[model samples]
Target: MTTLTVGSHRIDLSIPAVMTIVNVTPDSFYAGSRTASTETIAARVREAAAAGTSMLDVGGYSSRPGAEDVSPGEETRRLAAALEVIRREVPELPVSLDTFRAEVAERIIRDYGPCLINDITAGEADPSMFGTAARLGVPYIAMHMRGMPDNMQQLTDYRDITAEVCSYFEEKMQRLQEAGVQQVILDPGFGFAKTVEQNYELLARMHRLTGLGCPLLAGISRKSMIYKVLDTDPADALTGTTALHWECLRQGAAILRVHDTREAVQVVRLWRKFRENS
Candidate 1:
């Protein structure tokens, strides 16, 4: 069975893990995820813990398309505050720090302890990220995004979305392995650099990526890929997100990065029951 050793905790991926999003940024694509103050951050963490979230993915820097760049110092400050609250409230829950900067990852780990490094750039944005993750000895989640967030929307021109993404992960896993990084999770970046049509195509063929032998993380929670098709908004995308979550489970997704922990946990439970009977 595939597993991730996060700090002292070994996360079994046989049952899909729900990694709840705890965004500290001012402008994440999903408004419901943004926690601007200490009270809100603590409340969000508590709520997720109560809802049975497998892990908390706290991100300070916003990666939404066209998001303004945040300085590493500011990002670290925001994350430190959020991390402090999480440690105080739910110290035992596994945490994943969503960042691409080696400096940010190093400082956060040094001050707060170990956390899985979830880099949307996958070491492409920061050359030292792989080495940092390796040295810190934390599980790494590498997402496949073509360019920086501000310009990623313009870089979506893949001939075969699924095959190319699979190749990208295969090469990335090899590189991470060579860099001495252990336990890498692959995220195909559902809406990062892909168009709406490309996103659907990638989801349809996501099962192929499981052959890479790394756990897959699906982050399609309340994304435009769902709302755009249904002509709705993120707040109303929960039902659509649940439908996609079921499909992701069917396709062997090991983790679901989500904003709604309760709904995701329920989906995972139902999926587990279905799998047992199947």
Candidate 2:
């Protein structure tokens, strides 16, 4: 079995864990999770912690396609504020920064004690990100995105999604290791730049990515792949999302980044019970 250590928290990989989403920006594609205020953000984080979320992923800038860009200063400002609130409310909760800017990562580490770095760019946008993660000795979530958020949807014509994604991770892992990055987490980026069919195809073939020898992080909660396929909206895709999370956990997903912490925690609970009985 594998394990992930963040701060003093050690998460077992034998059973899948939930990573609650805390989007502190209004531009996130999913309207339900968008909140720019620090108080509301902390409340959500506290709720997730109380509900038993194993990790709390706090993102300052939304990476949704065509998302309006936020300057580094603005991102730092928002991230620092949100993180400070969460830190004060729940001192033991493990906080992760969802940012691609090296400066933002460095600033958070310098300000906060030690937080995980969840970069959507996978060190592609800023080469120094890996070095900084290594320097700070924090866990890194290296996701696979074909292009920047603004132009990603326009580049969803991949001939072979799995092969291309595996190749991308191979190269990215090499660069990050060369930069001395200690812990690494891999995310397939479900809907960032994939068609509905391609998204399902990726999910069906997700187990193939384990060849990279890293823990898998799946973020398929209420994305367009489910809502669009179910003929519903993000707010109405919770059932579909939970249904898919089962398949993801079965396919070796170590972490599930989701909007609903209680539901996901319950999912993990029942899944572990079933798995144990089996």
Candidate 3:
């Protein structure tokens, strides 16, 4: 049973958990998750908590393909404002700060105490991210992405997607350990740099990653891989998301990072029942 230490909390990975996404940016891929104001952010957090989310993942910068660059100061401001609202409204839930900048992660932790650092770039974008996570004693979530959002899509040329991703995590986990990061989580990066076919290929073989010895986070919530395949939009991909959520659980994913909380929690519960009976 793998466990992740998020702040003062220990999340048991033996049973899957849902981490709802709260995007403070105006231009995140999912319109339903875009919460720009304090009122909207708080409402979203409350809704997720009420729906039984195990963790809240708040993001200031949008990592969608070809997304415009957000300045570090603006990202920090957006995240700080959302964190303030989350802390005030839903203080009980553990929060994960989604970012790729080392300075942003450091500043957020320094001001708001500890949080799970979810770096989409896996410390590739910023060299100091691993050290910052270690220094702050926060659990680090490393996602496998080829490059920054603007160029990531063009760099998806893996020889063997599953093996390559597993190898990447092996190297990254070692680096993180050497940097003194005790707790680590791995994200397969559903839509970050992978194509639709590649995403499915990786998902079908995702269980192989569990051998790397860390909790795996699958963030395929209403992403283009689902909506694009179904000839639908993000708003209509909840069914696809739930279907894929079950697949992720079956494939040994420990956490589901999603936009819809209630359905995802239900999927986890059902998956657990199915597993027990199997």
TM-score of each: 0.98, 0.96, 0.98
Query: Tens digit of lDDT per residue, candidate 3, span 122-146?
Result: 9998999999999999999999989
Candidate with more favorable, higher lDDT: 1 or 3? 1
Residue 274 of model 3: what lDDT? Answer: 86
Q: Name the regions of candidate 2 deviating beyond 4 angstroms.
A: none
For 37-156, candidate 1 gives per-residue lDDT tens digits of 999999999999999999999999999877889999999999999999999999979999999999999999999999999999999999899989999999999999998888899999
Off by over 4 Å in 1: none
Candidate with better lDDT, 1 vs 2: 1
Per-candidate Cα lDDT values, in order, are: 0.93, 0.88, 0.91
TM-score-better candidate, 2 vs 3: 3
Name the better of 2 and 3 by lDDT: 3
Per-candidate Cα RMSD to the true structure, in Å, reads 0.8, 1.3, 1.0
